[model samples]
Target: MKLSIIILAKTDTLSLFQMTLNCIDSFYESEKNIDAEIILIESNKDYEASGFKYPDVVKVIIPSEKFNFHKFLNIGIKAAKGDYIALCNNDLLFKEHWFSEILSLGEDQNDIMSFSPVGKPKINTSNSSFEIGYKVMTHIKGWCIVVKKEIFQKIGLLDETFDFYFADNDYAMTLKSKNIKHALVYRSHVVHLEKQSVDSEVKSKNIPKELLSKYKIPKYLNDNQYSWVFNNEKNLSGFLKFHNKWGSPKLLYRKNKLADILIKGKLGYFNRFFLRLKF
Candidate 1:
């Protein structure tokens, strides 16, 4: 089956511009013999009109709304013609055999419906190495995900409720709840340049750290990935929407251990009530 990789980029800075180009170039090298199409969802207004061009292999989609993670992905997914779809963040550098390894694992485990490349820590007891170099994980990082197109038909599009953060958490919960399998193929590694575009925005806005502390976001999570917490009031509400749906894990939890506990349901239904009151 062919693969369609959908990348989201906002080229408001030189670093983002360079990263986007590098991301597409590396994918070209990694895809090798696989049949794949690269779809770039650029969040710049009139990018084409502004005379920006990508390689002929890339089909660019400039959406009306600038930057909503789920919205941008859904737009590209609709335009995708491949049998499999990958949602990717612009801040990643694809390694050789990235797509082929995932395809191989998919062929080996037909029961597993979705997959992610490892660039972050493995969370949850559900993560177990099934193959020599790979493990199936429930708690997945949204940075890069490869999914069967049919999975969207079964589970539906990404929940538009999320403005930015916790959408990955929501997706992970949905897959686990339905007993759908999601795997992290360690063999297919990607270098995640965690901060690029969003860091520039944070600096440009000059948001004082004292003000960000009010959101109670963990210091480490205050980076570009979770920077949406300070975007606006609507985006701020996403923090609670996620907790209300799944039990609230401690925002200040020592590590991602809280996520593992919460996903396992060991905390129980009243976990959010008791835990949130304390935080």
Candidate 2:
């Protein structure tokens, strides 16, 4: 299968850029029939002259003062040259045969709209027999997703108004409206170096920290791979905007664990997560 690997590059650090590309290369190194194009959306205008470069990555420079995640992703989405599109962040690392693993589970379907490979579990459990190594979810995480190009043709590219967050959830809602199902590829997984772009933008560009208050991240997630789960936030602007448009009891509770516990008491459905998630 042909695939277009789209990665968003939004940080000032060149090492991180090269590291992400290296991970991509490793994922592709073992495969021969999988025709794929790797594309990069460089949010920094100066990336062209930054002197740090990769040999084969197709770089599109999108210089924006306030980079809109949906807008930039749409840009890469349009430029991609494969039947399948793989979207990833600049901070992610991958295991070997990542492409093959994702394709193994998704290549034949039209409705399996999205699939993500989760990393290996520290301790294996009873559910280790899951074919893809990860459990299926309603929405593939924004950090990494493999999907058919036709899905976009059906529902349209991401809405640019979302600015920084919930773009995936909004897309998931679109899928829901059409009754599409997404999945998580259990065996195909990667290590996400979490928020390399956001941290750099915050440190270098002075973007506010409160922009991430809408969701809940676990406190136990101290490792780099788990970094995407937590952020330092202290406001509600983002939260209100997000929930106002797409809030549902399930979606809200899934994002904010505290809310689920407070509202559900002993009946919160999220407790099923512990029973279901063996990894």
Candidate 3:
């Protein structure tokens, strides 16, 4: 296979199932020429037993462990036969000719190890580390990115300690440490249905039902399901694990050689102690 698209299916609700199906359908519609396979990592056993039909070509794997983002991603990557592997979300719409454009860019550059498709709402700010295009980039759209299989051999697997968040930061930092190139290919595009995976508000507020409708989320969904419900605690642990492994998030994005030196040098004793104190 040329590419393996790994999508995690967490269909605890009707809307979630529909979104996953939509995402899968969009991929089939968009990429007719590519020799690609869709690997569905179904995390929810309840959904798996629900008897919902998936596309004929999708290869489904039911993990024995709970839904940890990196854990599942690693599983899918291990099973993939493709030279290029896309770690994708269930809540995304693959645009027309997306894979063709990405493949073209990858063919042009031998050094670029990974690629992220352009999304609807672009990153708000640009810095030395964060930019979109066919250059070496420190930033990556973690929601959906295609990585060459060789990157795994060089950087090793993603830190499975991250249950929900900061794994992308860890990977980006790893790429930076190795000086391996990754880029945002604007020619390739995807629509990220952000906050659809796990929505939470530390300071709670009601989101208008009409807004939910825009994402095709049923307003009738229980209020508890709307936010602060799924994986918040696990994601918190992921935050701590990131700091424990890579130190402060601020240091990860800072615009200086010192920050890189500090991060790449490993967290000093005092820094580690302070992180524990803060956490």
The 10-residue segment with the lowest total lDDT in model 3: 129-138
What is the overall TM-score of model 1 with all chains considered together? 0.73
Per-residue lDDT tens digits of candidate 1, residues 61-80? 88887578798899999999
For residues 155-219, write the lDDT of model 2, one tens digit per residue.
Answer: 68887767665566666555544444566666676777666556433333322446544345333
Predicted structure with the largest lDDT when compared to the true one: 3
Error of 1 at 47 (Å): 2.5
lDDT of 3 at 166: 70
Provide C-alpha RMSD values for all models, in order: 6.9, 8.9, 9.9
Tell me how candidate 2 scores on lDDT. 0.61
Please give, for residues 199-277, the per-residue lDDT of candidate 3 as tens digits: 4442234445554443423233245643532234444445556656665545434422443454456532233223223
Clashing pairs in 3: none
Clashing pairs in 2: 117-188, 132-186, 132-187, 133-186, 133-187, 134-186
Per-prediction TM-score to the true structure, in the order listed: 0.73, 0.68, 0.74
